[model samples]
Target chain A: MANQDFVGIPSQVDTRALNRGASDFQRLRRGLLFNYLILGAGAILMIVPFIWMISTSFKPQAETVSFPPRLFPINPTISNYIDVFDRANMGRLYWNTTFISVIKTVFNIYTSALLGYIFGKFVFRGRDVIFYILLSTWIIPFEVYLIPLYLMTVQVGLANTYTALIVPEIFTIYAMFMFRQFMYTIPTELIDAARIDGAGEWYIFHRIIIPLSKAALFTLIAFYFMWNWNDFLWPLVVIADQDKYVITVGLATFVGEYWSQYGVIMAGASLAIIPILALFIAVQRFIIEGVVLTGLKG
Target chain B: MIQTIAQKFTGRRSTLRAAEHRFIVIALVPTIIFYAIVKFYPIFFSFFISMHEWSLFGNVSPYVGFDNYALLAKDSLFYKVMWNTMYRTFAGTFLGAFCSLIVALILNPIKRGSILLRLIYFLPVMTSVIASATIWKWMLQTRFGLLNQLLSYVGIQPVAWLQSTTWAMPSIIVMGIWGGIGFTVIIYLAGLKGIPKDYYEAAEIDGASSIQLALKITLPLLKPVVSFVLITGVIGGFSGGFQAIYMMTGGGPLDSTRVLALHIYDYAFQRMFMGQASSMSFVLFAIVLILTLVQFKLQRVDWEL
Candidate 1:
């Protein structure tokens, strides 16, 4: 009787209920097929340029600029990569870029975390107002601040030094906001417990907060590094010395030095991308998740 | 009299609050100094410099005040640059967002190869712009370039992409989308992941078609993400698009690719019109603020998350 009732109910609910189930399965299958097709198509389109870059970088000068371009570097060579270092002082460029990116990343993570801690855990006077003011700074595009920042950098004798780059990048509201969001999810009772256990505020931040927030901190680290690594404008403006130019400017200038040779420039570009691509692969989960939530909230 | 007595007795609690306040202030000192030096000081100083005629060779010639602002409005190049900038921003944002969203939606349903696909889509975002832009510039070469080669296979003539004024800005837009769509796809993929599967199941039970579900449910739920992408798209479009433009065209072929940021870069660095450049920066700032506020207002209607 129970089995009969179930069959009867399904039949009576809608005349084509069973057909609907079949159609649903069909839709799912069609969706799966369509998704894979599009995904494969998208993957090819997105990665072709990168593959082209790598291939062209290894091609000989004539082959690189050849019409009906060769899909592969018919005769692969590392001379272009070698030329970048031998001709362009690629070592100094790498050092300069690494210096700015590393210092900026460290400063941004530390300072932004501390600010996030205060904003998240403390009930200070005008806290909301201060947070709002800080958030508002995100709306002020860097262009608006460039001229004045340049002047100040000149006045303080920090122009052409790495200090001008690292100092100004320290207080990123986007990073601060990310930290605060992560911090908010942490239970306040944990902080109260730390304080009750004779932990100083600094100690709590160091011991309790920093360790627990590694994911968010790592995300910010990756973000700041990428930003500073590829940054051109500020470095172009403030750091005018040939010896001080970062990898970006170096690559740009490299193109000029070997204007006729596309292979060498491509080689340098491929080298420049290696570190970031490696970082992206290693920390992709954190970054993609962080990017999505942060993009939406921001 | 009773209230006064009560307040006096509670003075000790207030004292503790003040102590806590001091600790909080002490903790925030580093951030305060950072903001003052990095953000606020530069902003005010930029305004100050825009009122003066200055140069890179340590000369603050004189305060010309509105003279710089007045001349900027009369400048034909200023209008041309501003219009080009608007075109780039709109075209980049629209095309990037649309393609990324569509591709992301299609890719979202695949249970297999999703991670690898995401990585591939995100590769460009991870790669440095100058590196990729240089490669793209070569590909777009009018003669003997990769794109033209491919176009020839289709029985079409190769067009001068970046050299012609008609094609220059659109060429940038196309490259901008190629470099940019990856980030948007990654972002949209994340947004899609956050959506619960139950909504689709319920929609299915209601006899709602797939397209219907996407429009009626998926889009509305994705509004917050859309608003976010749109705003950042505009912001990034205006500010960071300068890199690719600078590298590829140098605002070339008769200043067809000259954006406002590039304009500021030229005036300040090349021509040494510090006041006019600073004024241009402020104008860009104003446009960003107004556009952002308008978007903020529009998003308030259906506050999707």
Candidate 2:
């Protein structure tokens, strides 16, 4: 009967140790609550200005400049939206930005994808040499090359044209690197299978590679579109004519024309940001993966 | 007869390899040509132009072989701008990264409302610098600004934020941090998310306090992300600060904000000293390269996470 009996281990008899652990847990939990409240307040502080911008965009000019400012527009009007398109020539700027974005996206994706495909899948002579040069280009800041690029654009009759704006960015090494890393994940057997079926490299890339690489491509598209849309420097340098001005340049002009119209500037910014925001939201899932993947690779 | 047929087929196979090379060339041609014409050729041409004292007028630009660079060495503005750029980069990068990490760490411990916080933090990053600059410009206005209005509440006099030489650069730094914190937060958030919950649980079970847990586990695990942010923060802050200075201040208020970027812009665009600008750019480029290398060296080993 004694042999049949069982008792808890000696460690379990240490009730004071158990009490201390519970007390510590309670303290930590309380501390966490205070931390969370403070953090939330900080977050709200960070967000208020952005909300203010959107709110100001809705209000009338007088209301926008009101003492202490309003959190929400009292009488929100569509006038700023209308003004963005009608008075500010935002429509023209949209076209310019869209044109640049579309061209740059297509060119960047295709060129980078192609170069990445070759570099990733193929083993050819001078591959390492070429890749080394490409890597070297990553560290070379665009500021170093800006004046030269502008001079070259002017020399080549590309100045004052969209070509000048889009052409230089087509050789996006980051995109190439991204695609190369993604392409490495794809099994060689898939390619080999296609090759056995008498498929050419072009057919293989178009039919096989493109279809399989949707996630990365979308990430690239979203990223590049945002970049091209928001770019100020290159467009400022090359696109001299008003007609060639992208949104950033056009917004600068808007400021010059309506220097006092802060509401209108906000309106223009809202308009400019909407498409990129939409794109980011659309590809939100993939973007996180792409970003994390890129970080790890780095 | 079989040997002869095999020989003929081998000749055709060699021809097919040749054709493959041709196809590869064709596929690569457009990118190569565009890259050379658009990117590389311009870089080379800039080097050529850097040798000449070019003017906007029809005056012949005589070759000035390194004279522009030599002039830069003696130019007080050049040294001053370089100094300003370094200062801005150091201050902005370190402070920005530090603030971002703090925000990230604080948010990481809170399970609820983190997503909303992230979006809030990311808004400034998504907004245009020009647009944000305008709003901040209004808020920081000397006489009638909200910041001064708030200062009045604290019994302080209205101070010039952007107009004064003493305050101009600091104003830019304040704006730079405001504009920069969001992306930095996002980067840190992403970094924080990667830390496993088990690490914290283990620390808790071992009777380690929150501060000790953070120091031992979180900070060590987040080093790589920290390093990345630090290096990129420097680069982004330096370049972006220069940009804001150029666009917003025009490097004005006695050129207190005349960082190298604005200096380069003025030389290249306003003064039409393309060669001098190019030399300045190269000098800045060298500085950036050195700074980046130094950062990488300092943090390479610490990038355990």
Candidate 3:
């Protein structure tokens, strides 16, 4: 009966099934090719504006306002770049941004990791409660804190100073949470072994924990550097001195002052992007990991 | 003798526990204190000042309970800005997430040059808001703009993009999508990567069509990721929409692009209405809190998986 039942499934059925499968495979392959074509076109759309910016930056002022805009400059010139550097004080903006970003990144990584280690490893009274309270602070937007924070900074006489620019940003709640999540994956045995060897808590943290979590540290560095480098609002609010202004605020002010100077503005914008773009391209993986890790966990 | 020994052992353990507690406190106090000073104190202070009549550079302001709140209630621009904010949040989040999902789906099957495409898409995100918005603003110029020029090639008349109030918000929304889609793509890509391949293979063997496979298998499986992207997109749109608007529109062509954050900023800094701005800030905070709670409820479902 089993043999008869098997035979009842016709050879024609097998052949038809095979043909359908073959056609389905062909359709899928065709669909994938079509998708690639669409995605290729989308990629061009994504990249053209940047190309346009660079092109405009290189164009002569006359050509920037020409009737039929050119994708590439008709008469490319370095005058815009020269003017931005010489007149707009690009060098000062670069220095201020780099200095503040570096200082903020370093402190952010250290404090975030230290607090993360404590939260992940320690058992103390009110640990969960304190951590939850800190986490809830993430919901409060910077606008909510803008008034009092500004007032506090002003009262302390740190307004318009690099100290104001770099201090408040260093202690971020998100980075602390990220580092804590990263630290949770680290085994307790490693710390225990260090402690057994007479290592103090600070020694174990500085040596074993920090070294083991280099990936997370690097991730936070890239994240923090980009954030601080691109921060506009806080710096705009606090820093009144043009010499102290970060690249973002300086560029914004440049835009306002030179609204019609398209070529110079584009040039300034291009230069401002180069440092962070280089950083991003170099550490793209870490940035992606940091973002993904936070997305999944948060 | 036994009692003495037990006492000594217990005493030593208690001291060790005390030392551990000390270490914990020492390691954690600075961060907790800093956070309290920077974050918590300002939040409370903001609330306190919201109830007062304050001004920029003023040391003391008379307390007027609910007066600022009352002024906000009567301010018609406040309602308009709220509407603008909600519109941008909903429209931008939807368009951004949808476009990113499509891109992710397309790029998922392409083994070649996927990373390169991702890099290209993510470039705008890496660029500063000022730079990107500068380029966008120039492109959205009514005449001789790149966008208009491109439209002309299709035999379409040039439309005033940022200059017209009707088109201004949409223009910002479009740029918002462009700059934001990369983040959504990357997140969705990560989500796509998490979907197991064997399921697809099994479905193929069963003669499940590609669209069916996507609808039945992929969509259902990616629900958690979709929710994450949507919720975060909305949250980000509410809080951070100010930068782009500030750069591109400066809250007009008629305040069409004025969002809550920009409104608060204008009240506090530009207009020097600190008390009114603080009240508005609390309202924004309340909205964010409600949204965040909703996200938590949704995320709990994701966590169960």
Candidate 1 global lDDT = 0.76
- Candidate 3 lDDT, tens digit per residue, A1-298? 0000000000111112223444555656657788779899999989888888888899988988886888778778999999999877999999888988899988888888988888888877798888888877777778888999998998899998998888887777777776787776688977765554456667888899998776677766776787778888888899998888889888888888888778898898899887898888888655455444534443
Residue A38 shift from truth in candidate 2, angstroms? 3.7
Q: What fraction of the correct interface contacts does each predicted structure contain?
A: 0.67, 0.35, 0.62
Model 2 off-target regions past 4 Å? A1-32, A285-298, B1-23, B109-112, B193-199, B295-305
lDDT value, residue B205 of candidate 2: 94
CAPRI rating of model 2: incorrect
Candidate 1, position B214, lDDT: 83
| Colliding pairs, model 3 | none
Candidate 3, residue A265: Cα displacement in angstroms equals 1.0
Give every collision pair in model 1: none
Clash list (residue pairs), candidate 2: none
Best by lDDT: 3
- DockQ, every prediction: 0.33, 0.20, 0.30
Task: Compose the digit string of candidate 3's lDDT tens values, residues B72-138.
Answer: 8999999999999999999998998899999988877765566678888878877878888988988
Better of 1 and 3 by lDDT: 3
Per-residue lDDT tens digits for candidate 1, residues A105-190, read: 78778888988888887875688888888788877877888788887888889999988877777667777776776776578988
Candidate 1 reaches a DockQ of 0.33
Residues B1-305, model 1: lDDT tens digits: 56544653565446545655666777677677778778787788888878888787765469898788899889998888888998999888988899988987786665445667767876777677788788888778787567888899999899999899999899889877877776777677667756776899899899998789889888888878887788778866776577788888999889999998889988988898777899889888888888778867866633111
